[model samples]
Target: MEDHANSRHKKTVQPVAKARQEVYVLRDLKEYLGESLLIIFSVLLALVLTEFINKQHEKSQTKELLNNIKEELKKNKQAEQEQYVYQQGILKRIDSVLRDPGLQKKVLTDGTFHLDYLAPEGVSLHDLSRVAWQVAQSHDITPKLEFKLVEMLTDIYDQQARIDKIEDKEAAVFLNYESRKPENIRETLILMRDNYHGWAFDRAPALIKKYDAAIKEIDRDL
Candidate 1:
């Protein structure tokens, strides 16, 4: 009877010991799962933070580019206005010459015509600023710019190019006239005056209006 009691006690204690071992194993598994979850969460958090930082940096860069472009456009508009004034003055001179037959006779006979009155030496063809546009293009910032802003810039530059070309042609005519004989000078002056009037009066003002609208839009956006 003593031996049998001892054996029964041993069996109960063995089952208890096995249950404790299983509990320890379950606790270890829980700890390992928690550690894995924490690692995953940390990596995800890091990736999200990096992405947000990159986006903020890009936005700042884009805004800076837009501001620079706005400044450039302002300068261009001022230049255009000055050019308009210069051209208008030339047109007035041409009108005075055309209206006075006496002045025409004197110019034809003396060959003492002033080409400066036709094309001012100080005024350049499209004296507009392009540094900002050039930098933006070189740095691939156009893609980041708003679609409408890009379109407006393109239009303004296209008009500038056209104006420059016309000015170049006028300059060429003046240079050719300068080297011509006195008898041929009158006709050349007439041609130069007509060309100047056409571009200055008709085309330039339209381009200036476009510039005004575009600048206003840029200001609003900024």
Candidate 2:
């Protein structure tokens, strides 16, 4: 009878010990899982914060580029305005010569024809600046700007390039030229920026209109 009682006690105690062991193992697993999740959450938060900071920095740099371009445009506009007036003066003088028969005959017949016109200056060019725009493009900041704004910038620069080409076409005539011949002088005078449609002059109303429109758009954006 004692032996049977001892066997029953042993069976009850063994089950109780096994149950406690299982509970302890489950608690350890929960603790491990909690730590892993916390670590993952922390790493994700850091990555998100780093990305946000980088975006902000890039946005600020793009803005600075636009403002620099705006200032540059303002200077170029002024330079073009002055160039237009000077070139118009030369064109009007040439027109006066064109209407005069005596002057035309003298220009046709005379070399060394003692021109009464004093200090016939060479072709006047617009000092337009593309530095700021070039820098922005090189840095790839233009993609961040509004699409319409980029188009406007391209148009203005293209117009500037056209004007430069006109000036360059006639540059050979006046580059260190020392001829006092009346025929040559008259030809030079004729080609010295007849009008915006011709070469070297920016007096065309259309060109100024474009500049004004660009300035207005930039102002609105700012």
Candidate 3:
């Protein structure tokens, strides 16, 4: 009976020791998990800070680039304004010549402006065409503008044809004159060709392309 009691006590003690060991192991595992969690959170926080700093740096760079672009655009706009003013001055001078009584009667009324003023010297056909185009553009060309351009082109063509005949028939007349006259005619012809291309075609697409981006940006801003 004493031996049986000793055996039962030994069995109970073994279970108690096993439970104690399990409790110790659980405590150790909880500590390990807590340490792991802390490490993970710290790493995540550092990564978030790094990303925020990088984003801020990128935004600053973008703003700087935008400012530089704005400065360049401002300079270009000023230059364009100066050039436009100069061009207007030249047009005014041409208009004054055209308005003269003799010139008006011979060129404007008689429909010989291209021959008397433009084809002769000092004035250029390209300049004339550009002025006309600009005038039409400023006025926002419609059907009326189109009619004017067509009429202008036709009159200019007729005058040029007449001038070409005169050149072929009386080469000596041109040769005897100051070289400046013929040179002017040559330059005028080149200018006229470019004007024809621009007004009749070519330049419209370029203008459209120029405005397209600006319009889209405006729309985005809106």
Q: Considering every candidate listed, which one attains the maximal lDDT? A: 1
Show pairs that collide, candidate 3.
none
| Candidate 3: tens digits of C-alpha lDDT, residues 1-222 | 999988878844443454434344446888999999999999999999999998787556544433333343334334334433443444444455444545434433322234334344322222211333334334433342235433443343333333233333323322333312532444333343343343322332333233334333323322
Q: lDDT of each structure?
A: 0.71, 0.67, 0.41
Pairs with steric clashes in candidate 1: none
Q: After superposition, how far is residue 195 of candidate 2 from its true place, in Å?
A: 7.2
lDDT of 1 by residue, 159-192 (tens): 7766666567666765574635565655666776
TM-score ranking from best candidate downward: 1, 2, 3
lDDT of model 2 at residue 154? Answer: 92
Task: List runs of model 1 lying over 4 Å from the truth.
Answer: 1-33, 98-114, 120-126, 177-179, 197-201
Q: How many steric clashes does model 1 contain?
A: 0
**Could you tell me the lDDT of residue 196 within candidate 1?**
68
The better-scoring model by TM-score among 2 and 3 is 2
> Which candidate do you rate higher for lDDT, 1 or 2?
1
